[model samples]
Target: MGKNRDGGGKDDEIIRASDDLLTSLSKDPSIMQSIYALLPNQEKLQGARDRHRSLFHQVVDGAHDKEAELEAARNDLIAQMSLVNGMANLTGKHDPTIPQKLGLVHQTAGKRPSAAGLSVPENFRMAYDGRSIIVRGSAVKGARSYEIWVCESDPLTEASWRHHATSGKINRIEITGLTPGRLYYFRIRAVGASDTGPWSNFISMMAI
Candidate 1:
């Protein structure tokens, strides 16, 4: 009798361990659904399915928002790069001598006209010899040629406008047959194939 009772207790222990293992495995959907008739009600299973679906939607929406932010940042960077390139195209290479070359050089007091156009530099000067007005100036270093416009008054009216000379170089030019003691205005501009610089400061002189 004692041996039978010990054998029965050992079998009960083995059966309990096997039942625990099977119960753990039944948490998986494929295994649990195959044994659904022996498991809990439909409402509890549906609740678990709805929880997983909600979690999936949350992850997808979060990923979509992140992508949108990344796209916006990418577009902003592209626009900034384009703006930098445009400014670089406008500025060209850095040439330290360009500013000095473009600027006007001052004239000595005796050589400068007292009552003529104020702020006209000595390098861009017009003087009156007894026969004609002599206009003189230097061209920008890369300039191919220059154009000179000699007028009687300011550029506000067309009646006073006339092209005095167009020259490949900056040299002394004599304008003859002008009325003595008459005020005249002149403008000089430098040009190249790619660009025309701003007009040199204007100079005025009277034929004495």
Candidate 2:
């Protein structure tokens, strides 16, 4: 009876170990689903996934190539536009189609004469005041004040000499923030209540 009981005890231990392994595998849903699906159609699923992945990559590569071709075409169009603009300027005929910009260097604009006998500002003179140049001139009849213009380089064209400063109804004005010993060109115009006057002769002076 003792020998029979010992053999039965070993058999019970072996059966308990097998039950524990089965319980662990049953707790994992992913492992159970994988095993069930593979048993039915594993080969068909793998082949379909491989074919779809290859098609997806081919579509992505074609899109990238198309984008590169479009970028190259856009660059070519911009270069052609620049060339056309250059040709127009060479023929001394500015394209009216081009929009005007403030920062762009424009062609000289025609000036209409002021009401009769309105000449340039008279007695226009300058004297150094510390780091500034003092421009002084009296206004003639029909004149209100003056507009002053200055540039390091002479802007000979009327459009380039856009008035830099406007003075009060006084004869004297000071230009501050000048570089000492630097030569500056200045021009002035008599301004009436209604309209601007013709520009005066260019006056070149060195800042003291």
Candidate 3:
């Protein structure tokens, strides 16, 4: 149980624990399907976990320009933790033993992390270069990382948006692999240690 001095828990230890849990869940899809009814889909949860693991190793290697990668990894891990915690809470209400069986602790009701002090990002701007969209925003206080979401659907509603990327850099975050000449709506939010801030006003642009 390696933990940091601040008690935030060690990234390596977390990755190890998460890997074990993911393996167990993956080995038995029936149990996972039942447990995930009130939680995020298994694929999304595992994808986030894998992204965190990959980025964690990159940071450990002392690679250059890894700060942003580290932040993104931390953000992804945080989201997964939140989802697991919620799942634990829901499962505990029905059967206390289930959480332990799944390698998760029962989260107390109404004990979600507070987002009170976190502020939404400001001065967000965007431009397109070839097939990439360059986004910039003013960093928020106490922000651990930033998340970018893009909506490609027309008559864009709230549910149409999907997470695009996460980064530590606020000055210039480039999002590539977009369809050329397609219209895209983008927005950003700041992720704090305990919670996330509200998303900024979304802006639209042509990817080309």
Candidate 4:
């Protein structure tokens, strides 16, 4: 009735505009009576808009909740997939034929015979980068992993050495977040399926 303004906008915008229109119509009973007898009254239209507006808001909130649930489910599945693939890779390393049967690419390297006992890593060296140290050592045969140990105090004190990181790579391990000018002692040990080797001779490096 108020200049026949545009309709069919957003739910909240339309609802507010309808409320103002209803208030204007209530003040003028003459205009209300002039409405065709078959047409809905001002009160009925306002009630319908309010009901639908409430339902619209509920549906919007439900959609957001459902989206969050979907994201969490997807992340969980991704983590499980990573775990399964890592297991498959380890299995393939031991048995090269298994990867082909499982439809996974097998990395073919010269297969070294399994050692009776794990051997200690040797030739320990450290390079001083501007912000970090790159530690290297000779690879041990049949080694599955390398454990890096670091000592901030006296290297002679066995209790001072603490486990730093375990690397899948044999050499060129980068250690970061070191305090500048601090002297760090690092050592390495080879880990095999059946045995853990003794620690290598410690190497020292000063953080820049």
Candidate 5:
């Protein structure tokens, strides 16, 4: 398992807020370059203002320990550096992608996730919305990911089920592409590294 500095699968509201912020930060070209600059794996680029590794570590550690304060500081620094360019950070109490991006993990990408520790998803429901139906699910313990399978007809046979969507760490997903007011059957499963757990008890809903 990789050191999930991005908070692993823990779902804290504040952590999610921080993650959303960091994901936004990663988009700015200058800010992204700053991250790449400090990445241990990256070769120093010409003309890049390479920050001191000690200072970088300090910032990273501060993110984990002082997230609330870090949020304010991160915002202020971004505003201050609006013109200077190449300012970036991946520190946070919640940002899970940081460890992977910063070369801090040995995570194996594309490996099947395991579902041994999780039970079937619970509280599965469908939300009515104009022209779409949202599939909501509750997280299962010991699972890091989820797969939502949906069928337009009764799922009495394998051929009726279709893979719909997958989520990373979260339990809820929004689904579209169905005829409005059609009866749809849905089920979900916990995904593991090498196998998938049993499907949740199927639920049927009329799409709005």
Candidate 6:
């Protein structure tokens, strides 16, 4: 037996001492073959673990991309719906009169007892010449007369509306004494003996 440099037994000495009791079994080559066979299985297990880790990361990344795409699609759908609703509201059955033109009146016989239907032409125009507004629109059917209301603020709000002009069975009316560079709202309504109709839709004009 040889002594180790570190004052321990050498490798060969240690092996030989352990083999003395099993000298016959130590010579069996089948035992050494069994130990070597387990190494390939260990390598396979390590490869499987690495592949599983890579697949997990791929799934996480895919989920994040899908979430982002869904969010973008939802926003696009909302914008499209809003545009459709706005167009529908503009072309609906409601009247399109300016605020300054609104008044109380009746149109039809039976309907005259109720509310008078209000209307305003699509091509109606308003122009301000220094001090007065020239409002032009076609006459509404069954309207005996029209009343025009003008106000600096919204006419629907109380204390903001003021009478600007009134017309007798005519389609055109000119409003005077209005300030230049100011915004004006107008509407028109029809009148009957018993009651006055609902005010027409409001239209706005910016005085030049």
What are the Cα lDDT values of the candidates?
0.51, 0.55, 0.67, 0.60, 0.53, 0.50
Kindly provide the TM-score of model 3 when superposed on the true structure, using C-alpha atoms: 0.44
Instruction: Show where candidate 4 strays beyond 4 Å.
Output: 1-116
RMSD of each: 41.9, 37.1, 20.2, 30.5, 19.2, 40.5
Across 141-189, the per-residue lDDT of candidate 3 in tens digits comes to: 7888999998765212467689989998788898887886455667788
Indicate which candidate wins on TM-score. Answer: 3
What TM-scores do the predictions have? 0.36, 0.41, 0.44, 0.43, 0.41, 0.38
Q: Model 5, range 10-52, lDDT digits (tens) per residue?
A: 3354366567768888776587788565443223321222333
Indicate which candidate wins on lDDT: 3
Model 6 C-alpha lDDT per residue in residues 35-100, reported as the tens digit of each score: 466333435545544554555465567756455545554444433333223223233326433211
Clashes of each: 0, 0, 0, 0, 8, 24
Off by over 4 Å in 2: 1-113
How much is the lDDT of residue 61 in candidate 5?
72
Q: Candidate 6 — which residues are off by over 4 angstroms?
A: 1-113, 116-125, 128-132
Better of 3 and 5 by lDDT: 3
- Cα lDDT tens digits, model 4, 113-208, are 324566666666666433456777778878888988887754555787899988988667888777875666677788888777766655556566
lDDT of 1 by residue, 15-132 (tens): 6766775888876657766755533344643554455455556556775545554554444443333333322322323542332343321222222222222222236656533335
- lDDT score, candidate 4, position 121: 66
**Per-residue lDDT over 1-208 for candidate 2, one digit per residue giving the tens place of the 0 to 100 score:** 1223312224444456668758878888687778565332335535444544554565567755455545544444333333333323223224433322311223222233467545566666676433356788756567777788876532443453545677875456877776874555677777777877777655556565
Given candidate 2, what's the lDDT at residue 126? 71
Candidate 4 residue pairs that clash: none
